[model samples]
Target: MRGFRPGLVPTLVVAVLVPLMVCLGFWQLSRGEYKRVLMQQYAERRVAPPMDSTELAQTTDPAFRVVELQGHFDVEHSILLDNRQHDGQVGVELLQPFLDRATGAWLLVNRGWLPWPDRRTPPVFSTPEQPVSVQAWVYVAPGATFQLHADPVAAPWPRLVTAIEPDKLWAELGRSGFSYELRQQGGPGAYRTDWPVVSMGPEKHLGYAVQWFAMAAALFGLFLYLGWHNAGRPHGKHHESNQHV
Candidate 1:
């Protein structure tokens, strides 16, 4: 027992704890990095080469980003999705069908924002009956379902739709040829173009990661303290326990 020191316990615990904490920290960093890469991909896709919406329009996967759409607007089928906010303002997006006379294809154009007021219905839009050409980035709306039921059915046109999938929409309306689907182009010309670009929420995710790591570190510390060092115990519990054994 001569020259035995009491510091060894804390040192050993910290050695194990630090490595675990370090791994957790690195894991969160990696997640942040992955998010950054994805964001970069999104940005690059936006600026890469513009595509023809009618030609690229397919019944398969919903194409996302950088599509060129040119055709006449089918004003009759225009729909407004509720609850969209941009830059501290609330608004509704204008969605209309573009028909390519040559290919017989259709593209859904999300024209820009129209300021919305509190009302039972979306603001009415006067649409052009003649042929119109439109270009926009593409995106797919997420599918949403409740417990054992689909969400509510959408209103008939010039009506508001909630969580409508483009493909399902095309089928329901008997849509045909057109290229690219553009989202967030909500503004004038055809619709309001005032909506902000889509944010993948990298900052929010990184913040969440930090919170998780913090909780892990805190819980580890609390467990170590309670099980080994607290509860009216003396300062030399490790030494006493080790020596007594």
Candidate 2:
């Protein structure tokens, strides 16, 4: 008859790791659901008529809402967001301040991704001298980034940065209400703006959850295979054989 016995070391490792793996699977499942809701919101709002900056001001959650603004691009004070990747090629994202002509408010606008000719030389871009109208989606800064040191926003015009720190930029520009960023629609001073609707879609998260669960299952199986022989006690014929020996 089979029994349920396992070695001390294997038992200890399994006890510690199995639960951790299962917990990771559950976490990924939750993350997947969150991503699903966010993607749904994006899809629904994609077709809605664009709201102007004044209308966008009243929005409680302004992320992903299509919006428009009449502004002049601050070409001299633009920033190049470094370490951006597109289509397996390394590049940077252009971020420039847009001075709203109607409200006289300045907000950051992400022009789009641009490929680097090389690391040393900065990419060249031309901005329109006259005031222009822009249509874009409202973007709330989503998360934080890891940085060894705080990026100096006051270093120079056309700043190169690892991440956007709106507060620092606002302070540098001496502008107040540096709240939301605009993800520009294809227009003048815009590049390839095909940003991902969802950074990690539900399918990707679900796949990760499956992988975590699979690892847990494999660990349990290993514990069983390694410990199986140690399970059953000696019985009947085996007992007799032991006595004879």
Candidate 3:
């Protein structure tokens, strides 16, 4: 009929959409579990042998993990990531390249943390020259961002670096070693490596999951009511010609 009841079509549409929404919500629930498991494995596998960075593919498994490379710290090339702040204090972490005297393999070490006075104020440093061992985890460099002075083409130290280019560093050293950046584990340095607290913004996945589930529930209830309304109407008077499409 050209003239329809106020809530008839919406009720029918809602009935179907409810189930569709529930299915989607449960799918996300499953996905969350998957991420949790992978994270747990990553934590557990930290003690296992470190993978050769060049051989590792992009993976969520924890098998490829932290490493211990013994060599002297090349502090001359050592630099700090700019504008890194932690606990409301402005500071930078020390990143030094550790060259293995035996195998010649090297690791770019984020040795530790430091405090700075102002954004304009460059941090002070006093890294020792004696051979030092570095323990770190392999981390792929993130994408380019504005505001941070991450330059890859320039010289290693005192030159602001915005991104981690293993290829460029390897070239700077005259030989390629690994593909990932070394996240320094605490050793014999006063530099800070405390993980930064990321602000949980509105764009996070968990918030979206809740919204989707609410919509699904509303749809399911509407559909159930419609099904009953049509079924319980006086037999034949239920209007056979008015069947929902």
Q: Report the number of the highest-TM-score candidate.
A: 2
Off by over 4 Å in 2: 146-149, 232-244
> Model 3, residue 178: displacement in angstroms?
1.5
The global Cα lDDT (0 to 1) of model 2 is: 0.83
- Misplaced by over 4 Å in model 1 are 1-35, 54-65, 141-151, 177-180, 184-188, 194-200, 230-245
For model 2, what is the error of residue 147's alpha carbon versus the real structure, in angstroms, after optimal superposition? 4.0
Candidate 3 residue-wise lDDT, 95-186, digit = tens: 77777665677666676668877667667787767776666776542233464444656654655554556667778778656665667667
Candidate 1's residue-wise lDDT over 19-85, tens digit each?
6766776666776677666556667877777665444644364444565544577777787866677
Per the 3 Å backbone cut-off, how many clashing residue pairs does candidate 3 have? 9
TM-score for each predicted model, relative to the true structure: 0.68, 0.89, 0.61
Model 3 ranges off by over 4 Å: 1-35, 48-64, 140-152, 196-204, 212-245
lDDT of 2 at 76: 82
Worst 10 residues of 1 by lDDT: 140-149
User: How many residue pairs clash in all the candidates, one count each?
Assistant: 28, 0, 9
